[model samples]
Target: MIAEGVKAPAFSLPDASGRMISLSDCIGQKVLVIFYPGDDTPVCTAQLCDYRNNVLEFTRRGIAVLGISGDSVESHRLFAEKHELPFTLLSDSDKRVAKAFDALGFLGMSQRAYVLVDETGVVLLAYSDFLPVTYQPMKDLLARIDAAS
Candidate 1:
């Protein structure tokens, strides 16, 4: 897992709309990247819904929430549409971004992890949820930023 205070790797991956979603674009803003193994699975679905439900709260704190998976762009598109995800869902077909962030393992699947980056792209919080039972842990990320401020 990535440690706190490390500079996250820069990335430019395609979103559901094929737009290049670059980490640099989000550098000056708070960013929350959620890495999941696949789309439409029960745990993944619940995890995403957790983010969706608390998305307004995150935005209220000036945070951008992004979901990344090795799933194809089409899968992301359907998942986002089906869930009405208000934020971006990044596509990592070849897991390039996954490898860079060390969010993957030798099993060839994106792990269930969360990374919080400050305005400078330095990681302030990191967690890997083996079984995410709730979304409230994300609030801890916001708390960390507030404490830093």
Candidate 2:
């Protein structure tokens, strides 16, 4: 994982709608970059749904939540729509971005992880679970963000 206090690596990926989203686009805002294993798996679904359910907490803190996976844009679109996820779901089909953040797992899958980037683009937190079933709750992430601030 990228170390805290380091500048976040820049990345441009397609969102569910196929629009390119870049880390530079959020230069002046805090962003929670969530790296997940896949789109519709049981754990991935639960993990994303947790964030989707509490999306207001992030928005209220002026934070943007971005979910990324190795899934294609079409897959991301279907997953987000099916889950009613309000946050942006990004496609990292090449796993380049995932590797940069150390979220790449065995077999080129994206490891379930979270990277918190501050308004200045510095990493505040970098965490990844060894197992796909584990995930950090939105509240815990919010707490980390609050404490970091």
> Model 2, 29-117: lDDT tens per residue?
99999999899999999999998888889888899989999999999999999999999999999999999998888878998888989
Residue range 94-142, candidate 1, lDDT tens digits: 9988877778956888878878888999988876755544343546645
lDDT of 1 at 123: 88
Clashes of 2: 0
| Top candidate (TM-score) | 2
TM of each candidate vs. truth: 0.88, 0.95
Q: List the residue pairs that clash in candidate 2.
A: none
